[model samples]
Target: MHRSPTAEAEVAEELAEARPDLVSRYAAELPGARAAVLTRLWRALAYEPLPWVAARVTDGDGLSLRLVDGRRLDGPPADPYATAAYVTDVRLDGRTYDDPARLMTDLGVPHSSDLAAELGHSVASLALSRAGQPTVPPKEGPGADWEWEQRVVDGHPFHPNCRSRPGFSVTEQLAYGPEHRPLVGLRTVPVPAAECLVSGGWPEGMRDGERLLIPVHPWQAAHVLKRVGDEGPVAHPLMSLRTLALSGEGPHVKTALSARLTSSVRDISVYSIGVSATLSAFAESLASRTDGLLHFTRTLGAVTADSPDLAAVLRESPQTYAGSGERVVPVAALATTDLPSSAAWLAEFTRLALTVGLRLLDLGVALEAHGQNLLVVLSATGAPLRLVYRD
Candidate 1:
């Protein structure tokens, strides 16, 4: 989140190119059209191991990464953006123990920290021990080791997602001190489905004021919405509506997108808005020119359905001219043709974006190049052809 778009996208593209196998694995998540473009965009990118790669231990897990020319990445699968973890060593809080034995008594459960964090006003319980508690055996693990515990507790460190995993649901603070504002856990639906932000609202004295939609990064929202309206896939891949708000790994796409955006080397521009708002804004942005939004959309749809070569150009231009803040559905998962080598796929991807004036290749941009983001539909010949992009 802290890195610039150029830096973020560049990093993502690098990762994508480095791990084509991952990208290929998640190709089904995207639609056919976007799969074409992103497949090419990602495949076109050159891969180079920035001098060296490294590894290390973060929290309780292992992390590995490379020291690319940009962001100072510590190796060994480390999250490059973990620097923005909600909890770090800086949050102010204190722990006191009246009886170390009582504190020492195991809570008798897995994920003790989570239990500790929520039991009897969780966090405050740490200070609940009677002044001086007996010394309980310190929790031992790569992350819960003696050194980390002593430093964090005595140092008053704030932990970020200590018990959370990547793409996990995040807990957002309820505003208005939960007085005028209602509190609800942000949820993520495995498959996109219709769900209200708050569950069973307005009970007696409580009144529901608002409902939030899927929580995604500012740049990603517009692009995904555009994909929803893109041609093909009359019924969503699942055919069932599954919507996941930014919660847990289910909806927390921010960091993943962060990795993608930070991985590209292009001019990224994003105007945050709802699905309708994005549509209207994009429409207006192109209204004054010879190419209206509808015309562009139809052109993409038509070319993709009929001519493979034309579809490639239609896909390419909009991505380029529209700017790399990556429009909705930048990548599709379906294969539209039976072609070999990156040339054919790249051509197909480029043609489709051209219709909308999104030149992803010309500008040297790669969006959602991750395995799960790019979808490649196969042709009769058993080769990937059509491309698509989705959440």
Candidate 2:
């Protein structure tokens, strides 16, 4: 999947021709990548629920898990709250296995080869991200909100394929990936209002008489939409590459990006488009009861052409909550920022987050309040004031 359609044939031909030691180099890179993925997988096997896991034993060093096949896997203790974990070698049935593929082979599990290949991809992707790290260190302070997003090289704390992006060549990764901090140019297609299903009230500015403007990611336009025209305005790429924020200040646009990012291929479903306005209203009403401690962005508009791959959702940017000088930072990027990490600051943030999240859940709407979906409005002195939750 790393090769796009244009380069797929070239790569296949290169593989067929044994000119250099490309195969040997790839073989050399496999062990390190596999080890990194296996460490995360082992942590999941130890902490998360897996039917094949027969039992678990905890000790000072780490956790030991017994699989259904009577084989044992041991790794360092898992700290779910921690972002980056130091996972090196895993012990499997008294044998130390650094390569995930080898360990999976020893386990004799079904679909082991497929899973191993995925792990390899993850490992390779992580290495590329590391290599692309900013040569010059970032400025002393949290210079910009987008910088925080770019600093998140190590993605998900637990998932093995956290950085895995199939079908994205190295060049594409540099150009479009949020970690690379590239300003991606969106493509716009104006669809007549009569031809598109409109919900949540399409913004008047984006509407031209009876026609509505729909923005599409360039990759989506080329690969999935199968049509490209009108180079739209550029925008800053957020942690979620599919979402973009216009320059100066405006709404955050969620475009339908047709690609596998991490685990799921992100596509704007027709179901979401149909209920966007109603859901936004319901969410705002629920959030209003929280006494300003929480804010859920209003869905400004949603438009779709009766297709899953072609849709866009516009919502209020989280920056709206911050006052003149206050800053709103994504929770996921907090670890990479220079914001105050003192105990008191952390406790206040925890209280603010829990109060808002639990209250929303109590109100019958549970938000997927992960790092990307959550943002904190910090005072000039770096105090947590309020929380923002967005889809």
Candidate 3:
């Protein structure tokens, strides 16, 4: 396997030539980004079941981890939910270090090298993400749900590789990253209707006579399929970069993006398409048992050309569940709004989410209710009312 330059080096090189004006800002935000990523890494070390960690010890000196390699790592008391960059440094084997990547490298654990590289990318990408944002968030949250999604500058809250987009260049990140707020113009590849295995109703607009047009993310087109196709609708990239919110309030398009983001390569598998209709029906049936407390966005349609590299899934947006004067917000974007500050509001939201989640769990269906998949419907007064879950 070949290795590329460090993420910070790559970003610096790109910005020096193409975005010189942002060079200083990106540099300024690096420290905070490092701290942010370090915080997540610390939390994972303290809690997650990593095989390399043989034992965990916590006492007056904060948290300590004894690695399987006979080395010990120490850090400040970990707060699983703290968003602030309170962790600036930690001690590993009596040596003080600040960079999460460097610390991982020094640990010399199995696959630590790969994880270290991702941690480095996470730090650099996170800095770039923060540099692109306004210093202060808007006093009033945007009306559109997509706008709220963009406000989540950082990616996964707990993953060490939160902002690590392994294959995306800085240019591509700025162009397709939701936090950058770019209008992504999607393209469509027409496949013979006979060759496609489709579930539900494939829209007429996405068809040309006997061919079904599959929406393709630009990244996938240039890098994976290596062929350009007809232009489709322009859309806003949501939290999941492969999924986009189409113009004219159309269904959200989940295109095949064969890039490694965080943990996995995001490609729409054919197996998923094969079972999409059944899964959607099952989810709908389960949602009906919630008595209006929970809703699952219907998977409108799914099509695959017998390849994970070329597939698409169209689903009703969570916004469709919001009634008049109410707004549907992804749980990830809740931090951008003022509702989380209120003790009463947090309690209410927690109660609503747990009720729906546990109810479905009792029925033997466990939902991946992560911040991105779980959404909340807020009343006019910013009170969390109902819960929405989607794939």
Candidate 4:
């Protein structure tokens, strides 16, 4: 039972909305595929306590009715794919209804209720699916699920949790949406150099050495305590992988965050309520959706925010040392000409740096956000997904 193109586009737009990074990264693989992704995501929720959602219909034959969510209506259709092809147009499960009861019979609430009504729920019970990863491994195969205590939620408005939520029921948090992050594993920073932030320590890892201004703002740092409590690697393996190039006109960003919250909310911003308050405000809304799903990230300089970029280089690029009182004008990293900045393909490099800086902002965790603080792994080209941490 496919819906109308407008309806499907709306759903895809919802899923692909806030996280500009996701759009930037995976737009290529999304348009033509989604039904199976939706099926896998919803089927996994069969016995869980996640919220009810409107299933997007995707089929082309007579009553190829699967539930719009995962369980479609068992009925007849004009030609199967004809009457309701909208669900696949944008490639999402119908449109998003904030009300769980309307999306699922289990919620059992009338659809006419205030659309803005807020609900609280946990993420543990929600179904997890690869909405659009290209290389989705078998659900039962090795590394089938990301297997983190965390799972993305499904809701009308996505809200990714900036803070950790321990000992919370997944079902109870579903209504709150993605704003509630499931902190089962340790989220470590990937910094390998000694810096002012962690005194040369890894941003999220345990201390290792000494550095100045190593201060990690409470806003940018996700969590630095304890290793992964599970059997997986101490940190997410994805961080160890290389990042992809920005093939888009700019950086390709795919993340889950509030569009309104995209700007820096640190003490520096006029609109910022400080890191804690900004996070709290986000949490309040997150608690409302608790769908364990809010994926939004933005791109900067339309590419990456790295030292090589003109904007980033000029603002934060390292300066070369010159003899004192020699009337010598300070030289720049590229100007030092030790390496070919020209060979660096300066244009592409700038775009890459901007992309990284912007995504980290969307994540709302502490970060130097400069080129030096970022990591770029060369591996991970065809994988379905991978974790990214700024050391």
The candidate maximizing TM-score is 3
Residue pairs with backbone atoms closer than 3 Å in model 3 (clashes): none
Tell me the spans in candidate 1 whose CA falls farther than 4 Å from its real position: 1-46, 49-283, 287-331, 336-352, 358-391
lDDT by residue (76-183, candidate 1, tens digit) is 222322222211111001222221111212222234343222221211111211111224633532121111111211111112211111111111111101111212
lDDT of each: 0.23, 0.74, 0.89, 0.24
Best by lDDT: 3
Model 4: CA > 4 A from native? 4-32, 50-196, 199-391
Sort by TM-score, top down from the best: 3, 2, 1, 4
Error of model 1, residue 24, in angstroms: 21
C-alpha positional error of residue 264 in candidate 2 after TM-score superposition, expressed in Å? 1.2
Rank by lDDT, descending? 3, 2, 4, 1
Worst 10 residues of 3 by lDDT: 1-10
* Alpha carbon deviation, residue 264, candidate 3 (Å): 0.9
TM-score list, all predictions = 0.22, 0.85, 0.96, 0.20
Which 10 consecutive positions of candidate 2 have the poorest summed lDDT?
1-10
Which residue window of length 10 is worst by lDDT in model 4? 310-319
Model 2 residue 276 CA deviation (Å) reads 1.2
Off by over 4 Å in 2: 1-36, 59-61, 101-108, 140-144, 204-210, 338-340
After best superposition, candidate 4 residue 120: deviation in angstroms?
A: 22
Off by over 4 Å in 3: 1-5
